[model samples]
Target: MTSPITTSSLPEELAPVPATAAPAHAVALVAEVQPFPIAVAGAELEQLAHRLIATRWPHRETAADQGPALDEIRALCDHWATDYDWRRAERFINETGSYRTEIDGMGVHFLHARSPEPDAMPLLLCHGWPGSILEFRHLVGPLTDPVAHGGRAEDAFDVVVPSMPGFGFSDQPVTTGWGASRVADAWIELMRRLGYHDWVAQGGDWGSSVVDAISRRNPAGLRGIHTNLPLVFPTEAEVRDATPDEQRMIAAAQRYRATLDGYAREQATRPQTIGYSLADSPAGLAAWIYTLFQDVTDSGGRPETVIDRDEILDDIMMYWLPNTGASSARLYWEAERDVSGAQVIGAVPAANPVPAGFSIFPGEAVQASRRWVERRYTTVLHYRQHERGGHFAALEQPAALTDDIRTTFRALR
Candidate 1:
């Protein structure tokens, strides 16, 4: 069984988001997108195996199960070091056609796959922390080439999945202010650069926040958006008058904030401080990220029950191979400084005017009733509460997510 975990939950609603603005350090952006494939060297893989084998394990947790169990981690590391195939994961990435380009002084990497159908619409999929572009690896086929995945060609999409800065092959931001808004702006620039004049967007985790920013900007080409984790905070009055179901949602979130959010607190406050362990120790990093899968997935603390062990390893390798432990954690630090840049915890970005769709997974701690979401989105095209799935919806329930995305965009298309 996995330990109970809690992601950062919604707090008292804040002010509406401000208008989009360019970063002070904005520079001449490179007007080109270059091919950037995955090619990890054998020696690097060897080094990772050595590090895993050499990990100095901590003592087992008490029977209370506050975090990943010691025995479970040890076995996972053993398999990771001795039997895991990094090549399979690499093939999963390269097969989709990866590329990178300079946007506002940061190198952003992405996977672009065009659909075979002539009427396919441009679709941008954003992933958050602990999730790389690979999170959407399963959707590329179903969304881009629908006929092959037992779907109609009319539902096909020209999918674009980008590695949020500082996460995957993307370059880490040198200066501060690469917050959620900046990332959203870069995504807009990317779609435009690719000559996709009309497109829709979707995201979860920090990606949801980025999509929120993009919706606020309401660019001419952006037709609408979809989110699995919608960031909707009701008012004090609204809270007081919440329905029985809404009250239950509110209480669960409160419990999450009260006990299960230490990881978020630490990352928001001292990303660099925690970076030392996360960057240096492979085992430490695995346990830290693994807690979420346990706490959040419908698998009831055993993520491998739903997601493949190798696939989980693939997600971890994104952070390990790039040594992005510190860089990716800094996203929270930037947000806490001014309540800006990828803020998920108590952030109050302005309400968006674009039509939006929402899919709330039962395992997700932070949730909103349709009334709650519609108030903010104004034009709610689609809203669903699936009986299964979790925060990592793409990994846990790709088929459901893809179908939801296709369903939502069909109206606009």
Candidate 2:
């Protein structure tokens, strides 16, 4: 079985978010949205393969159950170098009709797929750390055209999947303050610019936090939110008189904080420090990210049980090809600083005022009981507990996640 892992102990500023403000140097509302396609240079792919071949691995984990085993990593690396077809992944992304637009001075890259149905609800999907837009790749065609995927046309959506700033192809912020709150504002502006006056929002991991921020703002056009990673922590009262489920979750959260969160601490405290290794070594980047995938997927022991090795590499290619190791990690640094207070060991932020829905998968890094989630999601339209899936819910269980989106939003709509 995979080792147990926990969510990042990354700090959040307890201070209330201020009213959304446009950056002083914000681009005008009429900023351009240009068509963009994925095209990594030939030499870069060659260089990556060479690096994989030249890798010098660390000694095997003394605790066999701890982190990725040495042999496992070597096999993965071998597959990456010899059999992974990044070109196929590139074709998949390009076919999605991606685009880049300037929002509040930062260039935001997004995939905009309109439904064949005349009247489809507009939905925005956000991804988090170690994840690129590729996380939601499988859900796009299914979400945008449900009819073709064995669903009714009425369930169709005009989907918008944006790469978070500093992640994927989006322009990385040179200065600070691109935290959760700022990203929430940027997403609102993005939807507005695209002429979506009313829409729904969804995310997992850091994306859940971003969507939570959006729900808090209760923006004009945001209809509701559906999050897979429901960041809900029990109150003091709930803790004192915990249910069996709550006690189990509380213990798990504690174990995660104590044992499996080193990467988060490093990233939050000093992204640039680790960025060096992540940037210079493809194998290092793969190993770092692979650890999380291995520990967090619903797969019994191996990540490949749920996701294809090539698909996993495709997600990594977003970081390797763009050389976004430093930039992407900067997001944690910015977030930790922006949300200044020390993160309470096992606490969810305050309840969101807007309508919300949560899907808690079995293998999530952080687990929460329904009563705990209901406290924060005051208007919880839906709350589900699944037997499978994990932090990468969209990628691991696309149909389940997509169905939740459809079911949750259908009520709100």
Q: Pick the candidate with the highest lDDT.
A: 1
Cα displacement (Å) at residue 277, model 2:
0.4
For each candidate in the order shown, give its overall lDDT on alpha carbons. Answer: 0.82, 0.80
What are the clashing pairs of model 2?
12-339, 13-339, 13-340, 351-376
Taking all chains together, each candidate's TM-score versus the true structure is: 0.90, 0.90
Give the runs in model 1 whose Cα sits over 4 Å from its true position. Answer: 1-31, 338-351
Q: Where is model 1 poorest over a 10-residue stretch in terms of lDDT?
A: 2-11
For residue 299, what is the lDDT in candidate 2?
87
Instruction: Provide backbone clash counts, one per model.
Output: 6, 4
Query: In model 2, which regions exceed 4 Å deviation?
Result: 1-31, 340-350
TM-score of model 2 (CA atoms): 0.90
